[model samples]
Target: MYSFSTRSSFIATPHESMAELWSAISAALPVTEAEFPLDFSEKVEPSVVDVLKRCRQQLYTRSGRWRQNAQIILDLSWEKLNTGTWRDVDKEWRCLYSYGCLFKVAALCCDDASPATVQEAIRTCDLGLLMGAAIMDNILQTIVRILQNEIGKRHSNEEDPSDGVSAKKMKVDCVSVPVVKQALAVPRIHCPSLESFKKDYLDPQKSVILEGIIDHWPAFKNHPWSIEYLQTVAGCRTVPVEVGSRYTDEEWSQTLLTVNEFIDRYIVVKDASSLGYLAQHQLFDQVPELKDDICIPDYCCLGEGDEDDITINAWFGPGGTVSPLHQDPQQNFLAQVVGRKYIRLYSPEDTEKLYPHQLQLLHNTSQVEVESPDVVRFPEFVKAPYLECVLQPGEVLFIPVKHWHYVRSLELSFSVSFWWS
Candidate 1:
């Protein structure tokens, strides 16, 4: 059912210049092609024609309301769906959003590859991804990759790069939390036998740190995931960022930002009011190039599914970012890639003692603050007794389903987690 064939160079023509890239992209478009069917015998929809016309005339004016126009159309499109959710919008609207981005792309390409211009173009494509549908034969992916890869190439030219892609930039090196109840540390197992792991830890529903196994991943060797490499490849892309010390805080909020913007604002700034975290994001689907660097552990095969069935997420942020005591539905392997994290995990049987939130939205999250416990409010929390581990790079911490865990970063951190039922 599957086959593979190899080809030489993908680009038979010269697309070395940004203009050339733009030209190739433009030619790929048939000037009058319709994005959707008209239902009647009409050659193209009026909306399609309107969008094409506006994109063509964009160069004539520097003052443009690109998002303004898209938003207007988006509002009308949502009405057709009986619900206003953007995720549930119609395909026609998606095509319209795509055209809107096409207009912005053309406008941006008019300028040379100044860092500002390329960055803006990259941001525009990300906007399209946020709003647009999978129309235009992945035009947004095409142009953005063209721009991103070009920039990455430029960055590669300037650095004496290493297999060491790490975030060694956080001001705080080792954040020590006072161990409550004389620490019961998670045991370290060096690639244990499947039977041993299942009997000793898995069957007993205990946490363990897997060591001396994941070091062979490309992310640890040839193509390490350093801040520099991440900036070069995905800095332009947009992702949801958590702005606060932790999600459990009253002032916490989520916002969309370019990866570079998150780095500059929260990771690089000397002082800031709150921490910014790129947490629990399915980054691999948006940027498949990054997925190639890490390999799924063979341990997952012990379960019923393989890599395709597992859910992988990325956690990247500055030191001091905390994940309040929480439990997930599936088993997890939280792999540290860049820096260190102090984790304290409790058994599922201790759920009643942990004081989980009653709210439906945060039911899985425990209310007892792991660091500064309120003794009078949550006295039973001290009785629950958790195991602590300082998860370092190259280590994988196994957390069984329904296990309560609190995690805090010790440095500028980048971690990948895989969850499987």
Candidate 2:
């Protein structure tokens, strides 16, 4: 009912209005009292379900014009207040909906060792925080309603809903339909089907050259893209550098000397498009096995590692060189040894909130810039929930793909990743 719009055959009924919808939600899923608190003096936190109840209570009184504002305030507060990090709260919300029930709120109950125990932390929270989370959640919910309505309207207008160009039938391309669908379906979470990818393209013992990997480093002292891009935005780009080698330490030192000399010379950004040797396409043509398994054009299998089902590769640059929000194809034990990057993650259940492009084959959405999103262009994006993480040298994130992600390097950065299917 919430997704229905006049353009589609489905019309908005009494049950779909904000007030009626809230009432149904309340009746169908009553809040469970947070029986315990983290501290004896404080009460246990209210479940998000309970929080929604309060929002609904207030929602019944507001004018239709103020409906959107009420939702936004609840959503923002939900993300920011109880969780400390808005990301965690967002994750919780999506998980609640995705699992098709609010019972998952039990996951947030308190543990003495942890101050932010699920129920206690939220229960004990002050009025300011409670109100804040409530407001934010409300906003997010309203935005989702709008986007869902638009998608339903489009899907309903289709001439052949059954034999249409849905996600199942889409082809991979420069603007991958699959990627787009995944991003939109769940803006927050990314769910890479590891089992499927492995059953199809599990390669062992892939190899890559030392210099070849460094060649993609955007933060390299001489990287032209770093200079050009930064010049256009910030006048300068200063990123830290660290070097290690599979070879002995002495060999690594010798390589560093060579690298330092190159840095002193000039900043040259190799055009990824022009550099055929730098890409996997040329190699795949030589080794056809690679062509079938390659997920994205930029993602390549460099060599098989010594471990079990471990594959080493240069993810190179993104397809857009800047990934739109989407998950990867495998469980990525990503290592960023060189350069720096910012990554934002969303859990699988956060799909509805993310408004992912809703096609199976594509893994990205049309939305860009997650924080302070552009409400006009990608209105659906405003409702997409996410958790952000930044990675530096020697840091690794065990990212479960299909868990939505957005990434950008602070400079020309180079990282090697091991993906297991």
Candidate 3:
């Protein structure tokens, strides 16, 4: 079952901030504690301490091996099922089954890919799902116990709020407000509009950015490059590039050059799609080491709240292309693989200090002439606690959402990264 879908047309406007949209949506569906219901039982509840302890014991000790083994079995089953038809089996399976393949593969890979891998993998999948269910059950039991304790407290407090309250009361009884679990039977936050995430994540019409490889193997084909007088941070030098003509349309289409052609032209944007069509049987295992410095982890489909997650983005020099200060929407692990990048970080509290726009269309804020930052436009920016990090090959940085940042590459560089919420 091959899966394919054409992308919708939606150009991202960096200038538009989520502030107004969030405010409007929230106003339309005002959440109130009064609307949040709680269901407490009359009987005293069991202590959560014991239940949590049990959950931890089961999760950490009893269930680990079974779950791991189950994952291994599933992987083998999948490989055997598809081996005949799929050449690039794993990648193609990914396109066809999406996360469904992940659940089975991870189960099989939980253990070594053994000979009886397929059957073992299916068995493991069942065990893993069962283990997961058991863990969830324990969690729910704990929640119910806590709720019961709260209800008992409320019953004992008929006379006076202060008189019935005791310091030794169960932690759950400390709740003066209602919980969603009590009222709705389920506790969850659903952001349905998050489905349209990719629509807003980037310039929709813009080509999906990738970390492309051009010259690989026969290493002599590409010249070794370095920049002198590079600013060093943590024993690495930063190469800054200043490419004018803000994000050209030509670059998005990859119309001007192929990645290999771009490499010869002294530029590269990572994407196999724009490169010459690769045959089903073709495999270039010997690509010039693009990231001799950094290591990128595998990718994952981050859940709901992070639907608008940014994947990987990279651009080679024609220096001085300033990426305006903006925070990635989810937790990000950024690595500087080939060249150096100067990064400035602002804490969440510093959003105001940086004078981030309230509109979603604005790409963070207009470039601050950092050398002589215009205090008039961003008066609050003066108070922002700015930290500088120069990423070189091999170093990775974890950046949380709402943490404002800006990056500038010093020279022609290549990099790879992974992100998940």
Candidate 4:
């Protein structure tokens, strides 16, 4: 039963409206003190219910000031409701439901419930149950669709005008290969069974180049992941791309760019002086459709945990991009997608010889430049034994945990790395 006070056109005061709403809520969903103690007085401070009621009143009385006041109240309510013991789960849930009801009422009163706003409410209020229920109303549903469409138009208008396609032509200096002692070759295999993979390489903590594995992937066949294809799929998506040759250089820095712009200026147009690399990014999360193109290797099953535990990351860049020698925490399977990469691996025992960075930020990374080493400053680097290989397209490389490795792209490349414990 929806009833308003007869005293005035406006709803009741904060306390009176909260009591009334609480009463209505209780009537709708009755609960006993035995199951969940109604002791909001002891646990919750500043009273989330009071703030919500005030928010509702603001929405009903002053529509212009509602967004600001409601945001404040929502923030306060979230701060109060987010923390509690698991033993008080029932009590917390009841409070959450009431809080969600207040959000619905406020949204309805304001008549400005955008999809983004509703989505936020779902995340912030009772994990979406109440907001989902409220949006079942035709008016709210229509409002959400209209707001979403408007938002899409606004985003389209705000897109970058220059897609880096017409950028001035630049020179790309030829990459120079460093001279080093001949290292053991990484064994290459083609479509080995899971049992063979585990027995031959995985258990031994040895790196191997896997061939003919990802030949049938969508990224390989249907979507070539070419500059045009990537620009079409993820052009609007903003991503962090490295703007210099290596992070260790004084001129090196990170910048945000759309996929199209990155492809245009870095990969296609070519900036010979400073290379751009999209490294160590979880691209699948930003463009979920890309995940459909690739599949996790079967050998990952030999690890300790479930498939969900694996951390998938993308490494995309021009031919000259380089990743300075660094070690990762978890075992890695790096799959070459578009082009080739030259990799050098050194055992964990060579940590002293590698000269790890002293600073916390670059602690996992080696200070020595593997391509052009300063033997005077780092004399021990000469003794470090390593394994070298050129990873071809549609091949995967298994790197054991804590193995110091350096990667340099031999051509315009895109690679996916799967990290698992």
Candidate 5:
């Protein structure tokens, strides 16, 4: 449940409604608690099981609306999560908090299904998914599906927008940033045999721009990944978006928004308060229809791992959004489906010169901003040899494992990255 969402119909099937979903989720509490071996925090005052039962009892016997008890439960759980150093909280306590949100969802379900109701339900489900342990996957997914179904119904009969047919495609362009200066251009190869690519590039771990490879992707031809197309297909789906110019900024934060909201704020008008990126997400899993537009690069077989081992993430955002100089553990094929990005790379051989962060979490990232390094602060960074390029549509950049890279979009951008050992 934590890792995969099967098309599997469960033995204990869950129905889709606030009330029905609450019952289904409440019923699964015992089984979920049983599945986990009391691994984290073996002792607790009001155990997760105790909390769930008490909350449920309160719901059953409430003199007033369920909100009285439910709201109290929600407030306490919400406070518990906020009061502590979040990572130190017991996993079981997180699960208990999710039950509190479930009661609230059930209470909301007892009311009419208005836009506000649906939005509140979505917020509860998203919060539970983010903070709770994987104990209640089916319950959360059921609520999400129901909310999505409601959203879909609202737009089911609406025709495409008036300007839908002539929606603008992202421009394929380049910018001359300082980081890309005084660097060798990445070598380009046109559809070399997999054997040649591996022997010449992969084994030596060289960065290369691969061409004539992804041109055949349905997203570019038969089913263009136009703003209009994506809005039509995935607008209703809720997704986590990074709200800032870059992830490394102090102001950088995340929130949940539907695809339509993202497009409207960041894509269509470019008028958002800050940059919004639907970055590094497994979008294919959530909106499977979008998955059919592109195929995995065959070169991934060189990882010598099964296809299932690959990690695919979607990077969709407006121009000027930056990925500060960082290194990924696995080899990556960064495929540009729409728009363009100015990319700069450094060898792991120059790791010391790059001045990596001292913190464990940011150790993989360079302290120097590749775009505009402070020569005085990180003097050695100027000595690092690097390669740079402006990746175009239908092009893929083969990034060897641990090669430090920095990327910034030149226009509205959508790229898919496939990582493998």
Candidate 6:
């Protein structure tokens, strides 16, 4: 059994800067002295201590041999730490200290270590600490600081302009030419009355681009909607940003960050591996003040839903973002508030040719790349008929329910999509 006093000389006071953080963490842990056994007849394990000591000795060594040896030691130490439980204070403290030391070494070797190794090291340390490890407060504070600094360094490196290649200039392939059938443009009219829209397009389940309708909206005339204005209004608000050139790629991931950080890191400065997109988000719900800027079109009343039942979503991002071919359950009115977007639509009858994904998560999305599809792999895609159009600022495009559509930004854009039953 292990034994140690709260007043033992092994524990030291944490620095002033991290005292509050250390206190908060300590308060949350089951760290009472009464929980530990008092007897010290049995000796603590020596294997974890020896492995951690070796890891520290070679922490700065960047060679392949050192990495292989350190990884082996880390794996062994993690397995031991994960499987053990402690009733004695002294043994638990030693175990926690060893795991923290191992974490520090892994962080130091991060540049040369695999992502899996780094993740495992952090996970093991977190588990040990949470399992009533009585590590010194000062030591725990030090480990936390080191981890924070390493994360800061990684973010800075990603934003560095000298990084070789970036996703900012990547060209998106929008399929312009017809492969199987000749493509036609969607009909466009200026300021059509509600009666005309209901009789011609809505009743027939056809799509038409309506112009001169949204010019009266405050979003069109008053709000500049520039990068600066967006940052000023919604900068501090938390939002989910799509972090890749396209969602179809395996590397694509989503992250939650402030609108300001999204603009600073992704919009103002670009990232080589991924681009940030605020797409299909209910911005109005989070930032209700923005709702005053745009009004729902009169045509939305023709549907079964009331004004309050309409779902309003915002799509804001840089130029290269693409929405893969997909269908929605309700009628959609996509209003172009600021930039230009090239849109293509396919009737539900052509679903067989679109080749929707077999995976449940992506069932609504097509597997074929609409912009530059592979002829041999998706041969039927060429035979599907589609309507194409470039929607300009202040234009609204009516998309019938279950109509397959794909959209790509032609420039820095902000658009609002309204969905109603």
Who wins the TM-score comparison? 1
Worst 10 residues of 1 by lDDT: 1-10
The deviation in Å at residue 259 for candidate 3 is 1.6
Candidate 5 wrongly placed segments (more than 4 Å): 1-48, 54-103, 133-137, 158-160, 163-183, 191-194, 212-218, 221-223, 270-273, 292-295, 304-309, 358-361, 376-379
How many pairs of residues in model 5 come into backbone collision? Answer: 0
Candidate 5 residue lDDT tens string, 34-86: 33222334443555445455556544443354556566656666777787698
Candidate 1 vs candidate 6: the TM-score winner is: 1
Q: Estimate, for each residue in 1-421, the C-alpha lDDT of model 1 and write its tens digit.
A: 1121222122223334755655554544433323222231233357755645554444333246644554454454434444576566666666665656766675566445566777777777776675566555666776777777767766677656552234334344445654534458888999888888888988777899999778999888988888877876688788888999889899999998988778877877556556889975457766767888888877887787766899999999988899999999998999999988999999888899999999999999999888899989999988986798889999999999999999999888899999987
lDDT of 3 at 412: 43
Maximum-lDDT candidate: 5
Q: What is the TM-score of each candidate against the true structure?
A: 0.78, 0.29, 0.34, 0.64, 0.74, 0.58
Tell me the deviation in Å of residue 400 in model 4: 1.0
Give the winner by lDDT: 1 or 5.
5
Q: Is candidate 3 or candidate 6 better by TM-score?
A: 6
* Residue 141 lDDT, candidate 5, scale 0-100: 53
> In lDDT terms, how accurate is model 4?
0.65
Give the poorly placed runs of model 3, Cα more than 4 Å off. 1-256, 264-310, 363-367
Greater-TM-score candidate between 3 and 5: 5
Clashing pairs in 6: 175-371
- CA deviation > 4 Å runs, candidate 1: 1-18, 27-115, 130-133, 152-170, 177-183, 194-200
